[model samples]
Target chain A: MKNFYKVGLMLTVSALLAGCGNLTNSSLSSHSNGTKTSKVTTTGTSKSGQYSTLLQGGEYHTSAITGLNSESDSDNASNPKSFEAGLLEISKKEFSPDKYFFQEGKMISASQAQKWLGRKSKNNPEGLNPEDNGSTDADKRNPIYLQQLLEQDFYTQNDKNYDLSGMTIGLSMNDVDYYTKEKYGAKFETKISDEQRLSEGREMANEIVNRLRRRSNLKNITITVGLYKQNVNDSLVGGTFFNYGVSSPGQKKVTNWKNISQQNQVLPVVNDEKPINSNDSEDFSNFKNHIQSYFSNLSGVTAQTHYQDGKLKGMAINITTQFYGVAQIDSFTQFVQDAAGKYLPQQPTIEIKIQTVQDPEAILVKDYNTKQYSSHVFASY
Target chain B: MKNFYKVGLMLTVSALLAGCGNLTNSSLSSHSNGTKTSKVTTTGTSKSGQYSTLLQGGEYHTSAITGLNSESDSDNASNPKSFEAGLLEISKKEFSPDKYFFQEGKMISASQAQKWLGRKSKNNPEGLNPEDNGSTDADKRNPIYLQQLLEQDFYTQNDKNYDLSGMTIGLSMNDVDYYTKEKYGAKFETKISDEQRLSEGREMANEIVNRLRRRSNLKNITITVGLYKQNVNDSLVGGTFFNYGVSSPGQKKVTNWKNISQQNQVLPVVNDEKPINSNDSEDFSNFKNHIQSYFSNLSGVTAQTHYQDGKLKGMAINITTQFYGVAQIDSFTQFVQDAAGKYLPQQPTIEIKIQTVQDPEAILVKDYNTKQYSSHVFASY
Candidate 1:
């Protein structure tokens, strides 16, 4: 019995290790146009039968003021007439690049990045300098920084026309490679497929566009949904993680923006032996369920449109219902089916980005050794 | 302008009822105990003080038992022993009665009283003798059957070692007059104060002795505390109230022993309007304090003891200290000069009594008109 128990334990551990290995090699990619296409197979049972009839064929329109502009101009353009007839018509059906990547002048400060990553450097290391100058290097590719930059750009560019009232949205699980390196002092191999990345990105972009179309200015708004994938190496640690795109309303001028400044960046220690695949599927499922539940429970969400760049993606048939003394969306499952039934045969995709991070101080060194850090990081931006 | 308006209104009223007088009187007595007691005193700068030290005496030993008969015949009779010792030595020290009246087992059914108070020649006009017939009168007095008898006996008993264990107590403001009228009718007014003619015989004897000694087992024990003054018809109604005494462990036998029939007697309800000129300096001080604040914050308490022959009386101090924290009392203004400064003046006290209730149904009639109820009634007793 003892030997059998030991063998069973061993098998479980081996399975977990295999899952982690798969995650390391996984490759996911997103198109520059915001479309996500993937070829990975899902392990879970499909509920595609529910998506029999989906909405399709919608045109996307762009606002006259799509680049970086002051709040006053954005407000003027967002007036009822422009918002309903012009700005809304354009931004409503399409996903804009300026809405997902950082604009030139809106990058976070080095101190802010350090606080998020839980580390400190000597000086601001911006541009090509990589001698721990306390600023981020423009050439360096930091996936975590890129994720934050995307979030900021998305909010600034789409906020005026989207009417994304009363929602909490943000990018999460960014800079996994950097965090892993700093905390674990060990490198991880990516296993996500490129096909999966593209699909996930498209799905996310479509969801965001749909959400923007149903906008109302009566509540707080948040919209976060996308995926990306990349590799981590010493040379890419100091480079800019997020590339600035077209600026939009409530944004600073591109001329006054710093060049890929490492203003806000922090290196957190990563745990070397901490297994990440123990419950990956379960974790993802839970995350998806949480998002669906949140949307389903919201009040006054009448309609939604999905898109990728300038292309119209899908639309959701929002049904309001009262339950437990509050107004709520009946079900996101129903919405997804009504919005993207034809798109279900293809596997929805998500991208995973990885990067190496160097920590000058041993601030989180003890935490890494103790295996106290959680694998999935949740970023507000 | 005011004269013209008044003249117009007057002419209208005169046209409606020219012959009706404005003055009128209702049949109801506004001086009922409940109504008069609810009135708030508007006097300014009334001298306020609390009851003095609660002497440890009377039935203290019997009450130490947590449950009914739990400590029966136990070798560790520490409680009973301490109570006896305290009562014996109370006179040497400066100690105040826990309250003024002893209400133990004064409850008696009208049927039970028929043999003692009802004359053989007396005939019920409606041929409904409550004693012989199964009537609601017996049921009405069910809750008070034991308390009234005890109070009457406790006041009349003179024995210092009166063993009043195994008796219950109750209280009622209307019992005395009810029983008196039922027995004597019109002659009640003339024979009420006569020691021989009064229903409480030996009990009154014992109580009178205790009152003379200024140490009553009746202290701090009453289910209800009421204030009354003689009206034009020489009937009881609400007025300046004072605290009543209750039976305690040391004075139980003396107050409620059934073998001593005279032990069931009640003290007269003293009216505050009547002048009190006691030779003792403390009497005047007590009267002043009692009139101002004693009744304002009276506490409620319940005590259990052995009842014998349906009579019980005793006193127990219910001390509850309010402190901002565990270390300090909230309102300790002056330290007691005596007893190594261990005591404080103006401490809260609650007098409870178990007296024979005349209208048992009346006990259920709470003064719902006021948000606060009389705190003097011993709820659980």
Candidate 2:
């Protein structure tokens, strides 16, 4: 019989699961005028259990349930994960898994979604994007504010059938509207100012909410909206959600909005004199140095950190190593795991991807508040 | 505001959903001893709602639930998806979606799994791999049979709790055992004959079933097993499951075996004198030519088709083109959708991916028994 590769899986498992809780408050903080404003929401953890059956039975659908293929349209690879994951995280605040089960959005048909994503016109009053200014010059721009619209429906178990009780909409606004003078022509970008982008996004949200409310079925359902700003096409990291608002049943508009200061910043800031979060940048630099110090053959170590308000929320680190052996990767993963524990903030979730020039060699993950990290090495035969 | 992109989504939606049913009989055919043998079993389609609440609530875990991270270890990119998806398909026959809810396997701990994936020895009898026969010659080799083990648990709602009702195990057996003599040494592969591989796989399955039965908690639970042969290291396509069996409650071993003749063959078969199914090969070739003829600048067109017994089961087509505009991609997708309808087999599921030099431009999917295909063109602007 084949012999097993001895690794401390049990030790890692117990450590990985330590400090676990069912539904825990995940707080996001932001500093405004030097005064910190934090939003506390209970996000369901892995231990809390993910989905519930539609009392009648079938699979729970997420947007693009087959895969997150809808978001795949973006050139930025990380945008899909950030958009989908961020929306789910935001949804948990309004629709708790304890009470509501998840389902693919049935309210917005694909055609309707397409219409809403297009430029405004008399024929298509439902459009949520700005009408084209008919400008060819990249500098004098008619920026398309909205890129994609994502819908998620939440259902509550009612006796025998699950009824739609709530809904969440994610509007992916473009930071830079991209276009070309003609088909296959040189691409051009119309850079949008943050002030204009946010204001335009809020207006679109209001219009969308009002239009959606017109439907008899959705008129009395609680609707939650998350306004997301997609990263520029060339950015390595993904975009962030800046604002969110919830309209109560029967409400026509989102009167009150909550400011969300979430950001995805590349670690080891290239040219910026002052990093957004000095402590996180410093911690990441130390972590990188510590791992690279141990293994001089390491090619490079880079990270994308997610921050809420000013606090580090998550870190995705990529470690490129020259070593290719399974045993060597396993040992290196352990070393990196230890270094991460010592140098990185304990409150944020962390993931390390060990890659060669061709493919991934191993991966290590640590959830927020967890004491231990779990690592897996691919068996390359 | 922007107007929607109209692409007949409603017609496609209705057409795409034709002949849909929940937990329907999915038959698998295999010709044995010149006699056609077919096994009829129920499988959960998208309509058969997937998960159930674990009374207490949380996410239903799958093996490598975070993502199929465990399978990502394989050098063959498609192996992970084939192994995970194929096993789930086989499991659906025994575990109906309406009755059983899915969860990650808890019975086999990660550490136990590592032990079982190892070579059998006096100190570690739990090992499931063959013992090392020290030999420098590749001709005289001790081949490793088991590459990986995957577990899936099915739960039935009982009163207020969901209890494990059945379990399925997927054994990823190697067709070619890959190894290196020393750390970072040049890689070597020992090809195992089909007859030897299948027999050894059966014996290993028996041992695993017996060992699992020894656990009191698992003693009475029904267990199903599927034996998969992993494709060689550099394969473009993944592996296939050849045999499967089920052990009833209180049964110690799988006494009756069923044959599965599923395969993943690259279209325009590279070197075989005759393709596995002549009709499928012809259909794929025609489809490729039809699409390319419409768009002359198309760089390349390739496909991966899956077959059950001798009939085509599914097709994944990749179409590479130089076109970059959203409108052009969208129109081209429509043309491909039409060509696929006219040229491909109607019974099998079909997916066509349209890609540019930089990234994926569009995607078209037509599930089995669906008349109209659903298409999405990425908004690249």
Candidate 3:
């Protein structure tokens, strides 16, 4: 009872101190007392006049947390570590305790994915060595390699951690993409997804997190995984949330995970093992030949087709006229669509490069192709 | 020992069955075997060819972990949830055992943050009556309110529980933004940041998450807090990781926490309160008037100033003359720079919106403004 009184007294004193501070704040609030105040935003049921209009046209300044990760300085004693990076660092360091709980045995396996995402060799599909064979450094920057480590390998926070019963292991799939024309010095005419893309993304993360729980060495360290469909435009468009720790999560999850990796971008060189015009296949060369023979020669128009994995997917057609009209565009699209229907038999669905064009960027045509059947979307980026 | 042998024998048989699947996969691998394949992507140091391509622009779909969180089919077979409204209905329906970890206090005291995010004559800056005052349903969508409940507000995951210790609580701040001249049917000529905007964003999320850990009710429930700088063009860009358990583990550390709430678009409200112009003070209205009198008057050049805290920070001057030489542009910029120096006293530093106009988006002249020193920037958005 005596201890309670003492604690209650301290609380009273603190409340009084806080009251003094509030008084100062109230005085500051007077700064807005003389303005032509009208609520700027409304709430669900009532008009909230709580927000005072500070600016209307010219630039307005608002308080923000800056250099949040800047090293802590003791010189400014008024600024507490609890306010800056220290707080984040602390929360990040030990957010998950020595032991946690999660469902077991539910995640996607790269070994299974190795059948496609990894090595072409079936035995090495999951890429037995995720370490980039050519790179001398560890595969820290390799998403696939790091994901392999995250899925197949486990680390425990406790040193003497041998018993691994009743603990939950987490699995995550982090994949990212990036685009920078300025860095590339050339326009890479690539396309991406819409809303459905994001919905599917969470599902992928769910798979990894679910599976990691089943692994044997799961302890202490909490794992988070996801994917990034990152792209670099006039500004960096994707890839956010970075925690300052001893590790680079980006090096693990999604860092340039979406790049059409230079190796994969190369035209397959004809080899002794695989003849170009073999019985069961039609390759890029054949597609290009077909495009040249079928479409480019159509009406004094030159066309370029962008494809991957030996199928015709994207094309840029020059219709001879720069300031083209809707009718001309339709006729052009119709012509191309007809050609695709005939020559590009493998790609049942196709679309034009809406951006790889000059301005006036008029949608002169109603995109006759849309009125027709939709083409299958191929690029996951 | 006999049971172990039986189980081991069953596992061995299953392993062989899996191998048969691999044998079939190897036959499919022959497809790439026919092509000259080389990995395209490089590791940090040297380029590597670790990837294998399967999509031939047609539909060569690879398998992925699906049916994750899917409901069990048999109604009486221990699991009878058949995939909810597409969301995973928790299997641990009431997972935690009884009164779990959490103090009695520490949630948003309806009295404290009744204003908006906090109190201001009874409105929470984050908004009060988060019950969606207009709607009478549960708060499954309101992340902030849910976070508050997860933090201070206590509820039993399952009844028959009374133990509260050694648990940590977490907070999340999920803010997103969008950019779609294509979707909104109109283009709001709002200028945002190149990098600093991203820096401030993480800080906001950090603040929320950090504060949550300090709350009394912070235990057990792990909160993953974050913000997103989202834009909708061809793809969805932000806000990914989410987990519901004990302890908040925010991911992607800080991505985009503030991009202006989409809800605020509803009103162009002007508020009423003591117009704190202080009779002789520099206030929001004065700044607006100053901008109107100064930059809006410049002939042949339409200018816009983006400010924060009522201080002008950015001015985008669009001159009709393009492909026009730099010298003439310098004269134009000088005229405006001089006006800014004289009129917008609060804003010492200003920048060019490098993307607002056509080519020669390049800085035509060294900003006389830069030689003149700079000021703090304030765009809370």
Best lDDT goes to which candidate?
Answer: 2
- Model 1, range B234-298, lDDT digits (tens) per residue? 32211111112223444422343222111111112244433221221232233223212311222
TM-scores vs. true structure, each candidate: 0.16, 0.47, 0.19
DockQ for each of the predicted structures, in order?
A: 0.01, 0.01, 0.01
Stretches off by above 4 angstroms in model 3 are: A1-381, B1-327, B334-348, B353-381
**What is the DockQ score of candidate 2, to 2 decimals?**
0.01
lDDT of 3 by residue, B218-278 (tens): 4334443322222222221111112222223332132323232211000111244232223
By lDDT, the candidates rank as 2, 3, 1
TM-score of 3: 0.19
Error (Å) of candidate 2 at residue A354 is 23
- List the RMSD of every prediction in angstroms: 34.8, 24.0, 33.6
Q: Model 2: runs farther than 4 Å from truth?
A: A1-381, B1-46, B49-57, B60-74, B379-381
Q: How accurate is candidate 3 locally (lDDT)?
A: 0.24
Q: For all candidates, what are the clash counts?
A: 164, 33, 85
CAPRI docking class of candidate 1:
incorrect
DockQ comparison, 2 vs 3, better candidate: 2
By TM-score, highest first, what's the ranking?
Answer: 2, 3, 1
User: Model 1 — TM-score against the truth?
Assistant: 0.16
Name the docking class for model 2. Answer: incorrect
- Looking at model 2 chain A, which ten-residue stretch has the lowest summed lDDT? A1-10
